[model samples]
Target chain A: MSAAASSRSGARFWTWLSVLVLAVLCLVWIYPFLWLVSASFKDPLEIFSKGLSLVPNALRWDNYVRAWATAGFSTYMLNTVLVTVGTVLLVIFHTSLTGYVLGRYNFIGRKLVIGVLVATFIIPAGFAIIPIVDLTKTLGLLNNRWGIILALAGSGHAASILLYAGFFSQLPKELEEAAVVDGAGFFTIFGRIMLPLAGPVTATVAVLTFLAAWNSFLIPLVLTFGAPGQRTLAVGMLAFVGTNETDWPGMAAAATLSLVPVIVFFFFVQRFFVEGVAGAIKA
Target chain B: MSLSHSAIRPSIRRRLWADRWIYLFLLPTVVLVASYTIWPMFASIWFSLLDWNGFERAGRFIAFGNYAEIFADRLFWNAFANTVIFVVVAVPIRVGLALLLAVVLNAGLPFSRSFRTAIFLPVVTTAAILGVVMRFVLDPASGPVNEVLLQLHLITQPINFLGRAGLSLYTAIGVWVWKWLGITLIYWMAALQTIPADLYDAARIDGAGRWQRFRYITVPLLTPFTIIITLITVVEATNVFDLMLTLTNGGPFFSSEVIDIFVYRQAFAANIPRLGYASAAALLFGVCVMAVIAAQIVVVARLRRRVAEQ
Candidate 1:
């Protein structure tokens, strides 16, 4: 009885030890973000004066005002919303249709299409940016929000398509057969039945796509290089740095502006995001 | 035989016509991918063979000229070396740390959910913005990191994390890991969930210690996932353009110039943009990446077969 009690105590000791370690680690992990938020509220001088302390001398709402109004983050935020929404809608529409067709139909060239899709995955987007830029420029899309939207959406989203394909293919054929028997056409069957049934997959795709489109930097940076008016928040942050080089407090505020919405969005849909990544890995 | 082939052709045509809406549904993706992905892939190769500044409607078809120049360019080689170092140093650290943390987190430690959210917050945050934030966070004079180090007597003077040539790349790599470590942790956690609880219970009943079960069962079971996770991390490490561009700008004497930065500088940020030369560098790097990916795929296939045999 003493031995069992000792072992139980040892387990408790280990659990407490692990909790201590994890608490420290999590603080370290989140310190940068906490620091950024605190810095945003600190006076420009106090940011340096206070050093590592997360508490500011006083709240500086003016930093946010500077970022939002004077620094033009408002415009950047609007552009980001427009571009992200456009990209997500386009990706979902295109990928779901392609996935539905590829998953359900046993058409000629289907294998070839899948093979091509898989092969393209090896080509990273960064390497192909120049050509994409050139193509976009040729099509008069450079400096246009549509250029950012199309480039983001048009990049062969093989993973999203595969996710949808995998999900749709597993669904019993009887669902579609009944729709067909009820005199449903292909568009109606897909629009009403297959798409609604793919709720989880759609959610996964939307969350992932939204994150990508929201946080995307290089493509938008390059595409909007000539047009400052078209700059998304990611690119605008860089311009903010260039213009407000010494405004550390305002820079933190700008970073917060770009980050806070996405963080809030993530908290809401992180479950789907995590599951989407796992599902993709399994596929 | 000719008569039979002719009869079957019409039936195939009819079947295709019956699924015409399917083809229509496929049109947008096909057109988009072909224009943006497929065509550009080949166009890059074609551009790499030319002498163009992107303003010219047609580049001079100087076959192999750009390739020859890239072979001789010292900066190209430097970028290549830096990329190799980045991948070699970053992948193992990222993957291994993620695995360890995932194991700990999966042990059902208190506040695991909150810990995960904290770690993953940076992953959702924009990398470019983080780069901007990190510059100040690691600022040698006024940054919190140096201040803390100094107060603890860790160093006599501040360390220039992003300004010093020797230290900038390593700093960028460290920041890159911090920003990205969350995604990898999630990957490891997901992989961990796949291990059936009964195996652990069985091992425990058989008098296996905690470390022993982890070493014997978890390690072996996680081998397949390790291959995949490592491959994903390696691939991701190569695409560090946004962060590097913001943090270092390949500065302090071009110390942190990965190939992406190299290509971007030459193509867009140069005094005279050398589109062809940039294309050549990108193609060469792309080919190397593909080779690495292919090698990994082969390794994964072989390992899977060996595991199945067991």
Candidate 2:
């Protein structure tokens, strides 16, 4: 009876201790973002004088408007949308077909091709800069939106394809067979049937690819350096900080603006995002 | 029989034509990949051998000279060391924090879902944007971090976070840990979801404490996810270019110069564009990263098999 009572007490103590520790950690983890939002609304005097404030004396909504327009963010946002959408569409279309071929078909060098694609995942994107730049210049793609799109399109990650392949393999091949028996052409079957069936994985790919392209800085930075007007939001935001003399309020405002689209996308499609990533990890 | 065999051959050819739709469907993707990615990979190999700038007309091939020079450069070595340090330190902390958060969130605490969501918010934010935010937060005098520390009497003087030489890497690592902990947490949470609840129940009934259950049951089962995520984290850390560029710019000294930034500086910022040398450094960086990832994947796979056997 005494032992049972002691054990109960110990469990209570542990539960409380765990809660305290987790609360501290949660705060540490979240403090930066809270600070970011706080800084955005803070008066310049308060920001500079008080360092950081959790709340501001007055809300400065103009900071966001000025940051958006003056930083050439309108153009940057447009470019990012175009590039991200273009890349996601290309990735979904190309990777599905290629992943389908590699997943479902028996062909020459199929394994080797898949292996090579997987290997490129670890090869840092930096290594290809010279050749990419040279090729872009040669093709007159330098400073062009197509340049950014093509550069991102070049590397299809094998893991993502393997993931699609894994899911595809589990899918009953009977559907494709039925389409074939119905005199549906191979492309038609792929386009209508297989593509539609790949919706979940497609969502995953779209979110991951979109975030990747949207966050891409170095590729576009080096590729589009000369064309000042052709900057993506990330690159533009960086240039904004530099040009605007590190305006803390303005910078924070821009940061928030740049994050709005992604955050919105994340909230709406977060279920798919989590499942997609989790599925990939499991495989 | 010979006539029948010839007839079958033509039918096979006709069937292939009928199936030509699939080939046509694959054509655009194949063309795009071949032109953009496959061709550029080959082009990189070719360019790595030449002494050509973006505009140079004719280039002379220098066999392994670039590689030799890359091995000799001091900055190349520093960048390599920084990349290694960043990977070694950041990957473990990120993974560790993530696993801990996953456990906490999965403990069935009230409002845990909201907690998980809040923690994971930073993962969705832009790295470049976070860089700017971190710059403001870590500022010596005017940053909230130092202000809080000063108020709490944690330090006698304001510590120069990103402005100091040795401390910049730590600052970058802190920013990295905060931004990355969210996604890694999600991965862990997902992995945790797959763990059978009965395993924990059995451990509890066997008089195992929370820590013991965590160590024996949770950790062991979670090993596969941990190994995979560790490798992913390491790969991502090694490519730490944009954040470093934005947060510290490899400054207050050259303390934070990873190989990616090193290549950029040499190729673009150098008084004379040593495009050849820069390409060589980049290639060396790539080779080193690939080797590390390959070795890690092998080790993880072997460990996973051993665990399964047990």
Candidate 3:
């Protein structure tokens, strides 16, 4: 009895210790975000004046407006929104069709198509930069929004297929069979039946694609080389920082500005984001 | 019945003609992939043969010469070497830390949900933003990181984390780990959730200690997630460029130059670009990546199969 009671106490002790450690971990993770928010409020002089000042001497809201004007962030924001929206539209259309076909239909080269698509995921985009440039130039897509849209769409095929395949495989084939029995063709069946059932996964694909297109840096940098006006928010912000010679206040403000769209985007759609990543993990 | 079937043949032809809608559905994807990925992939292979400087209208088709030059170039080798080092040092540390954190988080601690969210917020933010934000936070002089370290008496002076040759790789690794840890944690957390609670209860009833239950039960169950995360980490680490570009710009002396950065520099850095040489280097790098991925897939698949058999 005595030994059992001691062990029970030990368990309680460890549980409390675990909680303490976890609290500390959480603090560490939150520190950077807090620091970012705090630094954005500080002026240029106070930013580097003291080491690790948690409170700024005064708040500066104009920095946000100034960073926007100086970096031409409004243009970048417009460009990013265009590219992201375009990528999402293309992804939905392409994945729904291809994923539907690959998922349900029995076709020749089905396995090969799936395998090849998955294989491309491992193909590094950097190595293909020169060739991509050449192809884009030939297609007259360089520094063009269409170029960004196309590249994002092409690279997204594998992930979209993977996700859609998983979801579609779980879908009841009886729906399609019944639709066929009712004299509905492939188009009607896919449009009326499958697409509706794909709501969750479609949302997942949209969120993922939007995030990828929004956060994309290198591709836009390469494609929009020498044309600063064509740059996305990410690339524009990067150039802003690099060009300004470690201008901490301006850079912090710019960084914070760059995060606003994504943070807002994710927060609104966070339900789908969580579900998508969670489902991916389970798979 | 026979007469009706005979009349249906023409109907079948009309229906088949209308089924061209499938072709319409497939057209956009095929056209885009062909123009961007398929065409560029092949063009890259072809361009590897020509010694085309950026200014040139055309260049001599010196077959295999670029590949030869890549094999002979020391800077190419240095970049390759740095890539290997980054992958070797970063992936394991990042994955290991993630797993450890996941296990701890899974053991039923307070504020676990909020903690997970905090860790994952970084993963959602743009890496471009992270590149600049991290530079400020990790600044050697006025950076919060060093200030904390100094206060703790961990070091007498602020260390040149990104400037020192030996430490530069580690600094990049730290940033990479921060960006990636949340993803791994998510995977492991998912894996842990799949584990049956009764197993741990049984282990407790059998007088097994906490570490024993974790080792015998949690670790084995986590193998699949670990393998997948490791493979993803390897691919991600090998492809790291933006952070390296933004944080250290691949270095004070190319200390942080990975293969991707090297490829970027070769292709577009100079006034006269070396597209052909960059192509060869990229191909070589691709080969290395493919080989590693292939090995990982085979080994992990076999292990999974063996576990299933048990």
Candidate 4:
């Protein structure tokens, strides 16, 4: 009984030790973000002077004022919202329709389409940016917000489509058959019955797509090069750093502005994000 | 044969007619994917063959010349080498750390969920923004890292984490691992969830210790997921263009340049944008990535089949 008690105590000791270690690691993990927020509140001199201290000597609201007004973060925020919302809607529309059909039907070219989709997965879309840029320019969509939205959304979200297909495939076909018997057309059934049933999958896709579009950097950078007004928050932060290289506090403020919303959004929808990633891997 | 053909033809036509709506539903996806993904893939090959600047509508076709030039370029090799190093160094560290963390987090410890949220908060933050913030955080002069080091008397002088040529890539890799460790942790946690608790219980009942149970059962069961998580981490490590670009911009004598940055610089950032050469580099790198992916797929399939057999 004494030996058993000792072993249990040892186990408890190890468990608490791990918890302590994890708590410290968690602080270190979030330190950069915390530091950024801290610096955002500090004056430029104090920011460098306060070294490693998370608390500011004084709360300087001018950094935010500068970031919002002078650095054009307000506009960037709006552009990010527009692009993210548009991309999310477009992706849902595309993936749902494609996934619904692929999941339900055995059409003539079904195998061929699936094959093409799978093959494209091997080609990382980052490498194809040059041609995409050229193509977008050719289509007269370059330097346009709609162009950014389209390019962001138009990339074949094969995983998302596959996710929807996996979800839709498992659903009872009797629902569709019954809908058809009740004089429902394909679009009607898809819009009303099928889509409504795919609320979880749609939420997953939306959360994933929203995060991607919101935080995407390179495409928006290149696409909005000449059109500064169209720059997303990610790209604008780079541009902000470029111009305000010496304004560390303001830069931190701008970084905080760009990051806080997305972080908050993640906190709210992280359950879906976690599940979506898990679901995609399983699929 | 003639009668069979006639009978089949009519049914095929009827089936096609019935599936017209399905085809219509597929139209927008087809158009978008073809325009952006499929066409551009072929276009990269076509563009790689031309002696073109990005400004030109058409350039003189110089078949394989760009490929030959890329093969000869020293900078191309530098970027390629750096990318390989980044992938080689980053994937193992990221995957290994994530697995360990996942095991710890999956232990059902108190406040495990909160720890996960804290760790995952960075993953949701913009890499570009983090890149910008890290510069200040790691600044050799009056930065927090240097201040901490100085206070601890760890070094006589502050180390330039991003400025030094030898240290920049590794610093970037470290930061990359920090930002992305959460996703891999999640992958591992998900994988660990698949293991039945009864197996552990059975092992414990059969006089198994914790380490022995882990070694005998958990590790074996986790083999498939490890391969998958490793591959995913490898792919993700390769695609750190945004973070790398924002952080170092492949600076301090191009010490930190990855292949993506190399292509981006040549195609977009250079004084005279070399579209053809950049396309060649991209194509070459794309082929390598594809090969690595293909090899992983084959290995995974074979391993999975073996495990199934066992």
Report the number of the highest-lDDT candidate.
1
* Residue-wise C-alpha lDDT for candidate 3, range B1-310, written one tens digit per residue: 1111344445545644544554566667667666666666787788889898866756679999999888898888989999999989998898888888888888777777778877887888888778778877887888888888988999999987877876787898888888878878887888889999999999999999889998999988877777877888888888778788888778868878888888888887877788887888888888888888888888888977998899
Using DockQ, give the best candidate's number: 4
lDDT of 3 at A94: 88
| Candidate 4 lDDT by residue in tens digits, B1-310 | 1111243455777777767888888998899899889888899999899989877789889999998888889999999999999999999999889888998888899999999988888898899888888988898887788888889999989999999998999999999999998888888888889999999899899999978987999899898788778887888888999899999999889999999999999999988899988988998998898899889899889977987899
Task: List candidate 3 stretches off by more than 4 Å.
Answer: A169-188, B1-19, B301-310
What is each candidate's DockQ, to 2 decimals? 0.60, 0.53, 0.54, 0.63
Residue-pair clashes per prediction, in order, are 0, 0, 0, 0
Model 4: CA > 4 A from native:
B1-14, B303-310
TM-score of chain B of each: 0.94, 0.90, 0.90, 0.94
Q: What's the TM-score of each model vs. the native?
A: 0.96, 0.91, 0.92, 0.96
- Writing each residue's lDDT as its tens digit, candidate 4 over A1-283 gives 6999999999999999999999999998998888888989999888756557788888999999999999999999999999999999999999999998898777799999899888877778766798889987988988888888888888859988888888888988689778777998778998999999999989988998988999898889888889998888889999988988889999999999999899889989988788878765654
* Candidate 3: pairs in clash: none
Reference-based lDDT, residue A264, model 1: 94
- Candidate 4 falls in which docking quality class? medium
> Candidate 2, residues B1-310: lDDT per residue as tens digits?
1111243444646645644544554566567656666676666666667675555655679978888877788877888888888888898899998888788778877567777777788888788778877888888878888999998999989999999988899889988888878889888988999999999898889999879999899887887777788888887887777788899887776899888789888777676666777777777677777887788878878877997799
Residue A131, candidate 3: C-alpha displacement in angstroms: 1.5
In candidate 1, what are the lDDT values of residues B141-227, reduced to their tens digit? 789888988999989989999999979999999999889998999988988999999999999999999999999999998887888
**Ranked candidates (lDDT, high to low):** 1, 4, 3, 2
